[model samples]
Target: MVAADRNAGGIRGQKAVFVGPHQLLRPLGEGGMGQVYLARSPGLRLLAVKVIRPEYAEDPQFQRRFQQEVEAARRVTGFHTPPVVDAEPRGRRPWMATAYLPAPALGEVILRFGTFSEAGVRALGAALAEALAAIHAAGVVHRDLKPGNVLIARDGPRVIDFGISRAFDATHLTRTGMVCGTPGYIAPECIVSASVTSAAADVFSLGCLLVYALTGRTPFGSGEPAQINRRVVYEEPDLSGVPGTLRPLVASCLDKDPARRSTATTLLGALAPVDPGALLSPGLLAELDARERQAEADLAAPQADPPALPVRTWQSLSRRGLFGLGAGLGAGAAAAVGVPLLLTRRTRPTGSAATVGKPVDAWGVDAAGTGSPPAGPEPLWSKPITGMTVDHQLSLLGATPVWWNEGMGAVGYDGTTGRQAWSREDAQFFQVQNDLIYGTSLDFAGLVWLNDKAESHRSPLVVPAAQRDEAAMSLRVFGADSRTVVLARETSLTGGGIVAGADLGSGAVLWQQEITENLAVSLARHQDSMLSGSGSSMGLVADGRCYFEDSGVIHAVDLRTGASRWQATGVTSAGVPSRLLRTGGLLLVVHGLAVVALDPATGQQRWAAPATPQPIFGCALGAGRLLLSGAMGTAYCLDVTTGRGSWHTTVGVTTAADRGADYQAPSAGEGFFGVPLPSRPSGVAVLDAADGAIRWVVNSASDEGRWTTAAKGGTLYCASATTLRAFRAGGA
Candidate 1:
């Protein structure tokens, strides 16, 4: 939960910030450990700055061990290692700086592409072996060596996030309850009893990572931490996916008895003389080079304290939703910062849950009113949009429901009957504004617009200076108002991108501005296309100001000029607000369990509101009230205007990783909320919005698998792997 270590009042103490001789630039990311920043030495050399989390730094034993590990890491040297440049383990926040490079990680490559070629895997595996050999030679153990920690640069694979794995060792894992390594790649000894882990633990992790690189799947499979560790401790790996020729070598490294594994030196002897270029495809190489060049160009031209991203992605902050609760595990990621005077304590506020930014005389309470399922009068209709067994996606284009075919375009169904309505394979469904649907072509050369009648036309989406990575362009639609659309072309991972405003109808460019950091793009389950290559939208918009947030800071830009209006900082790094809502006379935003209200024009706080009783996983607002759903099926109702708590209840539900299903904001309607169950047993739990009454519950056919639910107006649409069903208000 430690996001950024904020000492200054807000974002404006920026006369200059530094650690030792390194000048702090912008944030790269944050994790359970601490915030990672992109910095420059007095010599202007780019460096990756890692600031330790307060909780860990505050521990006396941790600070002592951190110094020892830093010293140990400073001794390690190898061709595949990014050398540690500096450290200040006993400072106010305890930080370390390492060499920064423009390489993507093994996991990133697999996600964008697929499996690596055998030769590519061998070359990268060898590079990793060299890194391990050097670390052990320095008498240091890299307890965590998963795909997320290893960087694949133009030179070769470089292992990072070093030395600190044992900063709080096994004894701390017991004293402070720490997790050693990422689930699938963790060595069995590290899990059963951390006392036994050694250089061999690194060897076991390397084996798992190599399997992931070659097969694009973990050898032990992926799931809950305990389940995955159980397999690691007791069962042999499922190496069927690995190349036949390399299976034996990989198996030898994965021996249940850590001491029996091959040494890093032996593996490096085989993997040596690797060709870095062999590990990446030509297309990836081009994209990678372009991104690196962009970063170099940005560094050459220093900004006057411009908002920016990290110079490198050293460690993926998989905790606290830096990427939406599923960072290193995959799914999403983004960071934040607050304004000068707005930062407040993250603990729950004392006001009524129904508290508002300002006093409101009257408001509807439909979100917590007595009600029934929006799509419920029953005789629910079902239809198969396509195949029966692939990962399916569902969203609403106004009242029309659209489902995806993974890589292909999408299909539309009549909301009432689940019957095929109209299909468009040429251009996918994007965003809906003022009853009009907007999308980009498959190649992203033009914009496609569709009317409610399904009639369409194409307009060129002129994106200049955008990088093309094989299938998709880096240009993304920030969002649209009546006349203009906001677009940004990502140039570098350090967040050097170009933003532009264009005429939505003609796609004629109006103005453009170069951005130093990635915008807090407003992304919802179905706001835009679910297609892999289709870019995302910008942050929310209200009162002509496009409100975007990142690093816990909310920024507003004029939609007409693409100019910065104002930045409201002081928001806690507890959690990034998923959606910015415009209700009453305020902008309603929720981060973690806290709900906040800000003035639309000046980004000023009218009045602080109380948060929900538990950590909010999903939420919705209707009839003047906000409904928050937390883990273990706990739900709370608060007045949308005053933030006053009205009701609370627990509707039995599991806290499994259903890939965000159990966390999708509960569907709200006329009189009730429908909480989507995460296939522990696929079902819908309905509760009366008023008084938190348990109305009814209905389970899906066991064979249907996991169900994804969404609501538009008074209708609820739930889609399973093969079938899509529609329901209305009333009984179970």
Candidate 2:
């Protein structure tokens, strides 16, 4: 799929890879020094290649600009900036390539998707501001900052065509009288004099961009160039549609005086908390994916040869498919390092590399509950059901334990007495937050929630249209915080996940991010068969952040808006989730054989965990200590802050684990952790929280085909085909 740049400038009748030599072009600029011609690039071009004719390639001035743009681009690298890939300035036909972005220009998206929500515009502004900051920080000025120059990628906005502008170079721009930037979005100062353009000029353009983003019209109304320039230099911006909250910032960014404009850094600080990833509509996101697929399809069109030493480039495969965005930025923005999460082998290990026979501190957890219980588990209550029993489909909503009864739906029973609380056949419960039980309709197309009183609320989903027959798609809840309940839609378990957050009170989609990375892995790669009690396959939620491991990276997503707060990439996967867990005051990433602790706020590795005797499989956090279990019935406990081993122990049960047994994530809660014995799918080994002591083991009745368990609120719940039993630290 990845072929080198075959000779460009293909036949006139066939698809043109690059504008063939001798092709006629409109004279964009004519001056005393040189003449500039306009050349159009294909939408799906893998690299934003700027090709020049042999005559221009030898020009000292042209070569200088090409080399300068390449150097400037290489200096600027960030989530918002596309990287310079390959360049051949001195070649027969000089050419340079930047990561080709697949998404549409800002103007195109706005035209197709309509004006962004108020919050979305803010996010756009913040992201653009960050891009500007990176560009300026690299000492490069983006002379042209406009809607068309910015690509609204799945993850964030990408400032494109920054330094590399062959046909539209600064020297040519000034002579053409079109100014240094686009007419409507250009700063007044730039129109007045191109030579005076600076970073502040970009900020002015940013303001214009935001106004256009929010209102779908330029701050300076479009008209003849002279007229637009006159309005930009003399008139007050048309801010009627801009949000009142953002008007001030927009106004400041558009300040006529460059010195008076808000710096990108200041804008970043002011808008840092905004979750830009959460504001796009499902249609817009779907279109982004469609654009990528379309670009790939464009590549399939037969290649035509174009003579003249073609700019040689390289391409490799990646999760995104043949283009392999992870290596270099793919068609562009999604190719940024943020796209694919890779496991890093380097680590900032805690204490010292663990010594096998050495003694360390014991691990402990404190799931605050009714009270501290006895040392060992005690049977609480057992109830029999005549029908609808699916082992392990259990969750504790407050003082009630809810189980999924196949076909019939959710069945909830009181935690203390085992009396049936309320059964909802209409929906299946998945998460509980803010004293409310969150669930989805049997088809997973609608959102359903109920307060502790059993009062339920329902709202339809924007995606997964049931009427349209979208059975290939399934929505998974990332849990709800006080403000937003996030759900991610995916075709399958692996990649291309789009997470959207809905308002807690209104059930309206507030925000979402196109995380085309490995969604299933993020959700549960570590634990394949056994899912953590947290509801999803393999993710953790704490302090309003959802942490999950995808490929080799751990991403911390803000629950309020579904924006990624931080990404801890390169974490070599040691074990199953909560692989990306926030516990004991630190974020722990498990990959390979050890867990690494990172600052939850920054994702900076605090330390790598002490080693365990077996490959780590299961993990849980309580108080400030972590508990990780391994096969051969072995487990390790350690202080979260110090990474000091508290105690390591191996309980009974040396039976071989099931295939990919290490992939099954263990369930833990209250004060213990449990893993299936696998002798059958019905037996479980329970471990004490204070120490790695085996609290008790349960074997399913032969009649029960399969059994599953859930540990929550200091109680271990074992469910079979016809009965459910609750166990605690002591006899209830």
Candidate 3:
């Protein structure tokens, strides 16, 4: 038996000290994008760093795209892929780091241990299925899901290397003429059309990956790349040597037609019947068992050299829990990584983690069915949050975001629920024309609405502060004089801010000026304008003029004339525009690295200052203080006029850990709760928003499950997968 270090490739000869603060160890491999170095933090936290290759740095286009991709990748929160800890995409070398796993890729495992026995194959299938489920749920497609991408962790299998994934509804980079994926791993649709929906393409790749895992060969075997392409497009998979239990399922995955292929959900259900042990032939199973035992016996044996890639220690690598006897189709995926790391030649039970308690009620109804559903009662009307739904048509198309009339007000639903408890609706007052509700708290002051009607109200419209779409805002208030109504003008798509006014009883005009277009997402306002987001071309201003951005390219626009701003032809690109803010006679713009104070009167740049995680507005001017949040897990207190920082604090994703964590500021109670990551259990943490400081940490064993919280009567109600817990001020 050989030690893992035998193949270290003269690692000692290279300078070993790490370059990052986390101090990852020296790398084992280098690639086109970056080098993969192993390292550890002071507390023995292992990590992998991908340092960008120098040649790629010279290409500005690739650099921008890489930065954007890294940001998008980090936003994906789940257990399947490695999480980003620190990134320096703009640094001299540009690198990103993630938690490291002391495991081998499926490719390495197969090479070292020979081919997988039947049981090992079954477990591998299951793990892959679970990983895909999570990845897809995040609206991302792994484009590449092959053996080399699967990592076998000690406790389970993990999916990694998302360098080429596609986010749903995002931009595409591969030119029309170029091929985008590994040959064998490419789906038939991708190979044939080069343009398939993200979800469909991924399902196709899953099938191809399963074939390789089960038989140690691609469904379309070794051949010229061109020949393989032809075979993949025309041929039926040859499943000659695959274990019987896995043959049928693997066959379905290989369907030439993408629609005919089984969905991940369906595949997971299909994997249930196969016993992990049955996938292997009897003789091979016996041989593997013997080899595992022998390998263990030899762990202590002295060796002259690290064995080549293919060597196996028969004694030490037992095939016990590794048997995966009952693992279903998902088992193969799980087994592919889970078994290798988990079994450790030792026996342990293997099954999905106890369904995290009676499976979170898919429907909001409780055991009694009478408890309040999170969204509140059957709505007088219903509207979905902009980014909440999986369906994009709700926003891209002219779908009406429903507004409900509740008492004197209206609210928005959290999507599917009907109960009034969790639902949030907007209260209206057209009388207060052009006012919309837009704040983080439930206080009346936080609920004002901006009605864009150009006329005065029928009555004196008086209401709290808020920000909502025209439809929702109009329904909330009543205007008297049709002429004096102050409503947001439906000029064109991407129009500037929501202009405010009082509606005159007459149907004529009222006071109106251009509202800023800094942070608007409404299609009704910004329609005619192409979201001018190309390289150096920031998105269009609300009024359809050119705009500019840092991490995002701002579209060139004439500030004085609301005319279309022309840019150089062929300079096509897109980017996010930071909203403009007014501070102390200085017009402030929040770019990627710092807040630049511009002279609003002349459009001149004034002062630029740095900030942490990039400031995203959280609340309108509360007194003189501005509230904001960042990509990092914290919220900030900034001066509304000076563009100065006041305080910062960490907000839990939610009241409960199981509910998942969110960085949005919590409505101040005894303190605010951070939302938890969905994959993690529910717990609560309180912090000072004035200065990023944790006040308390409470573990919520939520019965509602999935870390979620609700506050009422001065107590924070929390729930997890199994238990429900509560916390309050003074730990009451």
Candidate 4:
């Protein structure tokens, strides 16, 4: 018996099943032609195996066409094209396998990270040109070259999925009245003639991909296929965001007249001078390497035979954890398969000063100094506070609320009564851990620690002006038991930057390391000018190590001796490590497009949860789940262990009224999690910790500002720019 037949027991109806020697781990996508599976060869190599429908395999004409196209695909081997590795055209289930590139699809990358910078577009254009050159050289026309078919590999962009590709001399297999490629990306000539497709058609598609990469949208706009095709054939392509340097070349390639379009070879010549390194960052490359390693490990795992049962029964069993073979088809996986598995302000006081026992209306005055009307439903108590910005406030468990503003240093409010418990007029709150508050003053002179009673602990450390001018500085506290606090002072020098750690409590300099000086200089120079933003540099203290990022690499130093522990590259794009959270022995960082969880002891990646399309606002880990929120009001919860999504919810639309409001990170506890609603009727949203179901939405006392929430001891605290309100869960 052939491998396909032997594996027939694993087959259950139309659901994907193992074919031949490749095990279909999961379905990548499905279309009219067939289904694509992320499969693994018996030798453990990853392959995107496309299996033709059984009915199609039985048809002699389809079989012949599949074989011909597979041969042509095999002949067009290039560094930019995923090579066809194996095929069985005559098997009971015809399938072809190609080297699987684990990187995200080009479309996915753009959606997650936003449109590419000019340099990125240039790099992508050049790589696509090279791939097209190879395909045309083999006498094949890649009829489909949309963003979805292009994978963003670490070394360069890779063109993939030659599903509709054909040799120049091959007969047309597509039926009449059928389009061969995606509508918006299809060439005008291909749509108009409905007959002839040449190498020039691929060029037009390349131009479309470039436009999409630069603008995060298709050139012709998107809609129903027929409408899009008409627009493609008649309207001029939109080159709005295309960088001026490449506009003319892209416009030429997208010309309606196929003869006027630039050929792949000509386009390659135009892109030959572009440097791929300028377009790719070290962090991105490191992420790619990690992903590749992960893929290898996943492939190496032995496959388990599917039990003989009904599809529904198997699904139920899988959900119950009786079987660990089935992959989740949740939002995370859906988003992945769609692409192949893809601020502040505060203010001063005003209003009536309401104390703990006062009515909600007496809680505070507005900017006008009149008694401000209650904005949301009445809470347990509300009190007005004085500050210009409330962006960096801390509400630690079992501690009073700590609020920080540029104008008002740090103020602590009673957790239950909304009374001012303490105030540090000279320091801006940085972080609160282990019942101790940490902050820095405006003069860059020293760090301060305040206890719950408002007692102060000062560490006199000053940053020189020269170092401050060259590099940015930040301080963080982390350790396994939350006992050790390390101050990470990063100095960006000319060639690279220096990162020095000091014991926060003792004011003792721990260790210092110099990082990619040249990269730091480049990043600093471009951060303010580039649309993709500058690379982030920041640090974290966690799990007995002082962790910091510089020029796309994450470094960890031992807390006891300040010795280097380990250095991992590409954990995140250039950005500050805004949040480092530890829960269940996993250390989580909100970076780039993922909420990455790492093993605290070894710095090994445990899993990454896919965040929303927008950048994450903050994240919290509790109830065995990771909760993430974004500016768009979207929230996602992932199982802590597996990183599979448990649920996702959108609180409300972000409004301009709340633009200047500083929202506190979401906090989880007591079977509930609280998220600050930043829209009209602004308030706090309490969600069931298990499934992210909204329990209630308690409107805030002020509608027009960013508000943040924290939950602990059955009390939910909501802080707006001018007011801090406390509410009891279940409306107390």
Candidate 5:
């Protein structure tokens, strides 16, 4: 469907218009050889129609190349690539029409969201690899497979801009000396000798794409084309921030020798175990859905024909014959046109007059209702924590609040006085467990542990001398008991390196188990890779057992002896697990649609909850209840022991553009649960945990107040972009 031209002011300068049966709405983009437009068919289907520049339209050479692009693109048929709808290569203004997808380019997503996580990168790699495989299977080579050509959509990443792509049998159109492709992503052979460009070159480009996805920067530094081209041909790629799990494969793809690079099929096989759906954030998916709905609505509206010329036809090139053309066309086109640029505009600040008044006293109620609720909502001291720059939501380090700043490590503040308690420089706080805070610091070259007093201890994470010096590493600490701490450590070089039990006091490793197989191996053995889990909670320690997931199996290990106690399967088949919680003698692991509760001692399944329509974002266990917040804004409370639903409620305002996109897991206190309201007049909804009834909504004046909320000690703490505010029961 064609997207409405919201910015169709006027064509700057152009006389002849209209291509075949499509009427041009607005110039989407213009390049030297062609111009793309947002156009509509007679039936009003929206399409992105690329029409060769008038000058090039008349060139027999350019005509053949344009025809080749249409044919090559038509050969790809899947959700990963935009489908060619119609084409008139022999017309007066040769043009090709493809499905119009209203989404940002991968480059734009990277620019806006910064770098993706390891899981996200893996998902992206898998999708692009599958796309490349399809392109190759059709005997076509996408010579220009860079970030700009990849569109991020709700369903998956879509490959576009096949202007330079050609079928294997088509003739090469470029002269010997001309090099093609975006410099930073160009393969070595393309820079050194463009004549030998092959499918491997596309593989090299995929490596560049993966690097850009993991680190906001390209492998080759951006600068003068000559310089970047030189680096692409000679220098080792800069994969500084690329996760270790993917570094080896990415490095192989970027190999200087084309023979060393993996084929699209091989790469797809390697990443097949990764779940692509897990890569997309709810917010982005919601935005994509909104765009699609808007586009559908726009196309459904009546469309008026803009100033246009009559459609002309030529009979020389038939659609079927174009697909059979030999030798393929060279990779050259006018700069890519018709690409959309998204801009966000914020509304003026709303006044505080609409803010919700002080709420009624609702505190001091225990789990069994031994204490009464507060008399009324009372104002607590609003003390600003100093040294906070680029507002980050505060997490609890016990009762003390802690936060991290880029380049500033972690800082903690006293909960009562708001006085600075301690600070750890050069380390970013990851999680808090018991009295120890775990974080990573490149300055220390490994994971570090900080005590409540801010004393630091480094873990013994040694690297082999033969390995690269700057190998990227990540740690997921499950929990720490009296003597042992259970954690999982992964290096990019090896997929899931090790799950170990470490000494709680000295940070010394006690026992470790190596995971030798990659995701591909795991999938081949089990038919599904059980990589899914909560992105936030990896595993949990309870009953002298260390619980964690590996390749779809939940494993229980003896904390003292490091021996495998038992293992249970069927938690998740793909995607990383969402969360692992231990409560009420049950070890719960939420992965994608499945929520399994297991006996902590025997690793036996107690009860498995049925899948939900949307993924569960957060879950809290308290007051004999387990509360879960879904991506679609649904809140569910289940009986903690049986995993049966006790109550379900739709808690917040959701729209097509942002359905449950802003829903965060509710924070549970003794008697109340707090959830952030992301809609207009942003606020926190305080609900009765027992019945799912709204007790009060602490509303803010502006939408900016919808940041993050945390509840503790009958107090609700709200962190906005600009400030942090705390609220308590009235007259507390």
Candidate 6:
């Protein structure tokens, strides 16, 4: 199938794969991202593959990130994390192949059978403590730890999902603005930024996970993310039912201060009995048994009244005031490193290295390269483009710079000679545009289609002439192939439409399509398929045929001949969906809880997974392996062939905070990093591509330096905000 036709008129193209139907046995469950399926291997070995939400597969950035995370996950050991058996990152519908261990999550066990007794809790706690220690020893931090992440097997407990966790030596994916972790179990420091460190944060999470294992709830109790974050940051955990003997250890682990929190190693030592026989003595066992029964009874009682959540308020007073007002427990505003700046440059001081030479024209040096600009590297080379500006909320397309001007407009530089090839100024007007540095497009028909930063659609061609009585306006047209810019009086919303034709020399428009006063939000295009969406319904063009929806009916029209094709049933919703994405040879319309994937050849149902309207945390797709996010802290991966649960890992809690936290909350500031270390420098390690084994690691846990990125053939550039650094990768 042609890329455009198979897409059903969407920007993303799907890769086709073959799978046996017998691979998938039974359906495990479903959530926001996709479905989990139970599948068996050819040798009768059990495995699982997760099918991703089609919309997620449509996002290139999300897809790349998902692949990176999955690849990194394979490097983790210590028997806590599940092992990845196989994967296909680039596929029609992505999925991961993992060994399907038949262990139930602690949450599932508790929900189905009831809470664990005191003896069981201690044994589980010891096992988990050891597990976390091993994970940390491997230089990993399990950022999200909860009952769901812990599996109960016949031998012991196994932890899963290193998705949110990072190795001690790497630049964190969460970094500045994104906050990741289960709300109820998140560390106190995690609320501030990604600067928090050491295994102590995991220790705090361990406390919460252990509390849930013993009492079947959070230590700080429940609410939305914002509500629970406050309690995690400030309020003391209520251990009313905890036995006196176990209370001390739990409290120590829950210490808000990392220094005070017990190390995973220390906990393991403390768990060891001076005398194992005395651990089961009659008197002691009876006392422990009574406490366990009481706790179980308490757990069974339905909360007569929901625990009172403190009313949160934004406070700008002193740190003490923030604490006093209970605002310290709230989530801090997501922040970026610097302010946003358009295409412009300011000269540095007289002796600054950046200002040493006269600026040259037409430069494009790989930011992901070695520090020394290579011999004959572009004289117009610049380092750290997007990192220089801070606008974390900037859409994925706007997050990075495309081709920008050193002083004038954008210029293209030759890859080999580092010389200016061509430059364009006033070529096209864009309100917001991010360029794609690593994408290719086929020159087909009279169209030069470019898919940059996922959603931006700008066409230098098809600049429509202005009517005498009309005022020239700038229009924002969104679609596949090309977005038209009309400089005509009162042309359309934002003065834009689909480009019919344009003059390259003068940038003039020859033809255009006029959209009615409907609220159009998304558009998709394929070889033989075209789809667009408005507030109430969808419109499509299949094989030169046109289709529109009004009320609850769909009408088809032939675009080539200007005739109608055929209309079918329409979808009804309160408003337009966020956007349309194509995958698995279909066009997908997605809202919070509803999804519809239609065949591009003919507008027919391929698959429709109704939305459950939950906050999606992370999504990934690989061939037959698919990972889906859950409302709770856990995530499920399944096999698409059999549609069965392969594995599940509790990552982060899905909850949004209502009000902002106090800005005055104490910040360790620069002190959080750069502290002189007494031990060997800790660093991030890259893994071998063929196997998930550590290849090399670059340490950054100290007062001396930080890590950053620049493009290199194999070497990745690492830098701090102020200093440029470099690291080498050993494997492909």
- Using all chains and alpha carbons, the TM-scores for the candidates as numbered come to 0.54, 0.45, 0.36, 0.46, 0.52, 0.36
Report how far residue 383 has shifted in candidate 2, in Å: 1.4
Candidate 5's error at 435, in angstroms?
A: 4.0
Q: How high is the lDDT of residue 472 in model 6?
A: 17
lDDT of 6 by residue, 319-438 (tens): 111011000001111110011011122212111011112222111001121121111111223233232222111111122222331111333333223333443343322222112211
- Tens-place lDDT digits, model 1, residues 275-305: 6667778767886898699668636644333
lDDT tens digits, residues 613-703, model 5? 3335566666667666654344556665876555544445443334213344467666666666545556666666766655656665643
| Candidate 6 runs further than 4 Å off | 1-22, 30-35, 51-68, 90-94, 163-178, 195-197, 273-732
Best by TM-score: 1
RMSD of 5: 19.1
Which residue segments of model 5 deviate by more than 4 Å? 1-204, 207-379, 385-393, 405-408, 440-442, 445-447, 453-473, 493-495, 515-536, 656-663, 701-706, 729-732
Q: Residue 394, candidate 6: how far off, in angstroms?
A: 25
Q: For candidate 1, give the lDDT of residue 39.
A: 71
After superposing all C-alphas onto the true structure, candidate 2 shows an RMSD in angstroms of 23.0
Give the per-residue lDDT of model 4 (tens digit) for 262-333.
Answer: 999899899777778755555566667887896876575556443333332211322111111111111112
Each candidate: RMSD:
13.1, 23.0, 23.0, 16.9, 19.1, 24.7
Give me candidate 2's TM-score against the actual structure. 0.45
Ranking by TM-score: 1, 5, 4, 2, 6, 3
lDDT by residue for model 2 over 563-654, one digit each (tens)? 87998654442112334555567766554245567788888877755444344555656556566655444456777788766765443333
lDDT of each: 0.60, 0.56, 0.40, 0.58, 0.57, 0.38
Candidate 3 regions with alpha-carbon error over 4 angstroms: 1-20, 163-176, 195-197, 273-732
- Candidate 1, residue 283: the lDDT equals 64
lDDT of 5 at 593: 35
